[model samples]
Target: MTKLYCLPHAGGTPAGYRTWIKALAPEIEVVPLQHPRPSDDEPLSLQEAAESVVEQCETDEDFAFFGHSLGAVIAFEAVRALSGPPRRLFVCGSAVPPVEASRGRDLRSLPDREFLQEVARLGGLPPEIHADAELRQEFLPGLRADYTLAETYEYHEGPPIPCPVSAFRGLSDGHVDKDGLRRWGEFTTADVTAREVPGDHFPLRTSATFLHRAIRKDLAA
Candidate 1:
């Protein structure tokens, strides 16, 4: 049985995949990577965080990666660092070859209110969370830190990976343009495919059946 390592987007907790895991096949062991923060422990640079994931996956039999947004970029880099190849790599809601905005930058410098506004503009955070003052304060710092790490990530130019790559995006995703999504093909030697689902960036929540069928088909191939 192959292991499926799941990585969450910026400001996303491991809990994000709880439902998806239950929906996946039992043969696929799901391991969600936890990003280190000041509250969680010592903070890790994006590269360090990716290295940690590769380290933990070292003992697995066979593996695959599924990452969303910021996590997609990290999963790409982690596979590059691996001692061996994974069975497949699925990157959703993220661009490949690393876009400038996807690289780590210090977004924490922004005023909290402005930061939340910027995130809302990006289309991931819920409007309700933004409306509640207490919830906004509680979630803002972690979101900023995650965005900073993502903005600062630097992509290394290298030979294409030997594994199959699947890039997924929503038809209405405001963040990932088609050209950016197509760039993902350049990273793989195996067949590369791109899919557009029916929702915004977080299509898995609304189109889980479609996502699952597509992934299951790819994994079987």
Candidate 2:
């Protein structure tokens, strides 16, 4: 049986995928990488985080990769750095080709109010969190730190990946444009399929059944 290595989005934790894991085929082992927050006692650079996942991946069995947003880019690079290739790659709600301009910047440098507003606009956080000043105050720092890590990542042109790649996008995702998603095809020598689900950027949270079915069908193929 192949292992499924799951990666979380910016400011997201392994717990976010618990429901989705239950819906997946039981034969597949699910491992969600828990990346540490920059201020959470132990901080890891993106490269360090990726290397850790590579080291922890089940080496004896076939493995597949799935990621969303910032995790998507991390998963992609991690596979490339692996000793060998994964069975397949699935990415959701992220721009392909990676964003070069945002690399190396500290997102915490932005005004807290402006940053939270942007987060709300991106549809990642619940409106009720922002509505509660106390909750917002508690969560915004971690969110900003995650953004800083994501925004600071740099992408270097390298050989196109050889494995099959599948991309998932949301029809209502304001954060990713269609052309940006379509460009994912350029990274793979094998088949690359782009699919659109009916939700915002957080389709896994809003439409888990639809997303799971799509993933099951793709992995089966």
Candidate 3:
């Protein structure tokens, strides 16, 4: 079986990819990974997160990586850190390319209410959490930490990973336009394929079928 490691979006957990395990069954083993959460005393950095992800993988074996939003950058960094590269890299919903990338805005300093509102605007926050104050409180810290990593990301031009890159963007995603999606091509020497799925920034919710079908087709190839 080919392992398909999945990294989640900001404030997202392994559970986010739970359904993928079943969806891409027997042939592709979906291994959803979690980045470290920030503690009050210490915050998690993107490099640390990438190193942590690298440690979790079986570098000796063949595998592919799929990442969404914030996870996309982390996965790209992890791929760079790997001694052995993945078969392919699927980056979804990320507008910023890895070269000199830094998602604009200081979301880390926004007031709790405003911060949540901003993330919600980007379709990063869940409606259930937004409606529940307690859930919001519980979720805020990690979200902020992840956002910090994203907002502070500074990509130095390094050798592009020796793997084909597949970029996916949601048609209705206000954050990512066609030109931004095309920028991913700069990071890879191999072929780069870009597909626009139907939805807003959150493809899993609005267009899982299209997303899965595209992934299945790539994996099959």
Q: Which candidate is the best by lDDT?
A: 3
The per-model lDDT (C-alpha) reads 0.78, 0.77, 0.84
The true-structure Cα RMSD of candidate 2 reads: 2.4
- Please give the lDDT score at residue 176 for candidate 3: 78
Q: Model 3 over residues 107-134: C-alpha lDDT tens digits?
A: 8899999999988987788788889999
Q: How much does each candidate deviate from the true structure in C-alpha RMSD? A: 2.4, 2.4, 1.6
**Candidate 2 per-residue C-alpha lDDT over 7-124 given as tens digits, one digit per residue, 9 for 90 to 100:** 8887677777887666786866678886555655766666666777788787557888988887788788888888788888889998874562343445467788877776787686
Which pairs clash in the backbone of model 3? none
TM-score quality measure for candidate 3? 0.93
Best by TM-score: 3
Task: Assess every candidate by TM-score.
Answer: 0.89, 0.88, 0.93
Per-residue lDDT value at 117 in model 3: 94
Better of 1 and 2 by lDDT: 1
- Candidate 2 vs 3: which has more TM-score: 3
